[model samples]
Target: MPPLNDDAIVLRTSDFSETSMVVTFFTRESGKITCLAKGARRLKNPFDTAFDAMNVCRILYYPKSGDVLQLVTEAKLTERFRVDSTVAIYAGFHVVQLLNHFTENFSPQTALFDLTKIILNDILSLNPICRSASLEDPPEKLSRCLLHYELRLLQLVGVAPSLRECVECGEKIEVRRGARRAAFGMREGGVLCPRCRPGKTRVVSLSPEALGALQLLASPEERFWKRLQLSQKTLGEIRGVWNQYLAHQMERPVPIFQWLKR
Candidate 1:
């Protein structure tokens, strides 16, 4: 087939042979693709692209027949996420890893792709503003960006947790004026009201602050997230909820979670 061009974020790269590398990308036009990049292992490769994780580039590749990996002929580095902090860099890794694992090959996820790109840029931009300050404090911008990206990704993929209603009994969650804390059923895929919380397994309790922040994160209005802020305790609660839901959905451990939790 003819060479296809698209903007992509490098997800993972591994040496295929002495002089070639297999590079996986989550692209804007194509969801996720693995391509064999010839001479990619050389000091000065022909593709002229760095296949490092979290790097965004414009790629030109020839699709192979059947199940064969595509051949990437040209990859030009369009953007590199340069962040000084290890926390920032790891946050970016977590974003790309989520995109890599949640998406399917050749399936177009334009909205998710766009969200991933923007979140990466947001994580990168944090370094300049917080250069001297520590991110260990409450109201962490990095945590907010990560949370927003993960929430949007699940929504785009159609597995977003049912926050508005109880998963077990189909009751409205009354998020605005209900109990101070609520139960979230991991397997049931939504919040569980007190009436339906009996004998439930794999559930986590969410504070009112956490639930409100999650609603804002999952809001259709983008400005809600931009103005949203969370305390360290609330961020921890939300992250726990995300971990449980993602674990239930993905059915395996996401390696980046280790670094992200730290």
Candidate 2:
């Protein structure tokens, strides 16, 4: 067949033999794919010797059927992320993990791929030093970035969490005193209005503050990031709510959230 060429982000890399390596890439044209880079592990290899998580690169590969590995003929690095904070480092790891786990092989995810590149670029540009940096709180800021990216990814992958209304009854959740205490319906797959609250046993109270944070994260406003600030309580609740929602929806836990906690 023809050579597949695309802009891809390195999601994973593993040594396949003494001199060969298997690299997993998430590309704009192909959602997720693996290729065997022959002799890539040598001291000086033709594959640039620069495959790592978060590296954006141009890749050319030849496909093969079944369990046989596809040959990655060429890989040229386009961008590499550099962040000062350990949390930021882990956040990149989390991004790669999500791609490797959630994406389907050879299926194009152009929007998600573009957005993923943007997320990594933005994270490194901020050059987060630590949670105690003078610019902002490290964990708080990085977590918000990661959460925001997750929300966007969820949208791209057709699993966006419902925010403005109830998932069951189509009732628009009112942002007022009594109605502000909305219930997060995990199985129902979104926030449930109090009127439709009794059916689900896995429901948890989602405060307006926490919901507001989710709204901001799901928002497209560029200035929102600069103005984004979350109190510890609100952040915790948002994390908890999304954690349950994501876990229930994916039928497994999302380990990336733990990176923020650390």
Candidate 3:
């Protein structure tokens, strides 16, 4: 097989035998791929700094036809995410985990790659800004940004919940008393009108304002960041919705979320 060169972000790596490593990377052209990095664990390994998760690199690999994994020939680091900011570090880990676990292999997910880069850059930049701001503000900002990234990630992976009319019935929903007069159906993948929501439906009550905010968030736009403005309560509601939706779609709990609670 001919060598292929691409830009990639390391997603995860595991020790393989004594000197080799099994690495997973999200590549620009080929999407997610697993590669065997021969002798990458040795002291004089050429891929010494290139195999770390979240490090962007230029990689060369050779694939055997019909094989599940490729052999990495060369990898050179392009960008190494700074580890100085704890918040950025955790956020980077979350992004890598989502890419590694949620996304399918070789699916041509270009948007996911671009969005991940944007979020990581934003997170790194936020560190200095947060340091200059009030003590309580950083966590709030980080949480809001992370929530937005998660929502965007879901949309990119084609699991974005329907936020328009009822997911079951076609009727539009109304909100009352700071709660959706309607209920959200995780199984149905969207809001359900009161009449359509079964007694057994798992619903998260959301306010009219919160519902409106979510609609705006789900809208695909290049300038989404400029348009987003959420109150703390509304942010909390959005977070809850994303949590339930992701849990349902993934069919298992994500460990990184537990880390977020700490």
User: Each model's TM-score?
Assistant: 0.92, 0.90, 0.87
The CA lDDT of each predicted structure is: 0.82, 0.78, 0.76
Q: Clash totals for all models, in order?
A: 0, 2, 0
Please report the candidate that would top lDDT against the real structure: 1
RMSD of each: 2.1, 2.6, 2.9
C-alpha lDDT (0 to 100) for residue 234 of candidate 2: 84
Candidates, ranked, lDDT:
1, 2, 3
Query: Per-residue CA lDDT of candidate 3, range 27-88, in tens?
Result: 98888889999999899988878888888999999966564779998999888877565556
lDDT per residue as tens, model 1, 1-262: 7899999999999989999999999989878899999988988877664688888999999987666799998888888877887667667778887888888888998888788888888887887654555435412777777788888889999899988788877888765655658899898888998999999898888877789899898865679997887777778878877886887899998766754442
Q: What CA RMSD would candidate 2 show?
A: 2.6
lDDT of each residue in 43-121, candidate 2, tens digit only: 8888774597799989999987765678898999889876667667767888888767778887798888888898888
* Highest TM-score scorer: 1
Candidate 1: where are CA atoms >4 Å away?
Answer: 129-139, 259-262
Clashing pairs in 2: 31-107, 131-138
lDDT at position 175, candidate 3:
52
After superposition, the stretches of candidate 3 with alpha carbons farther than 4 Å from their true spots are: 129-138, 174-181, 259-262
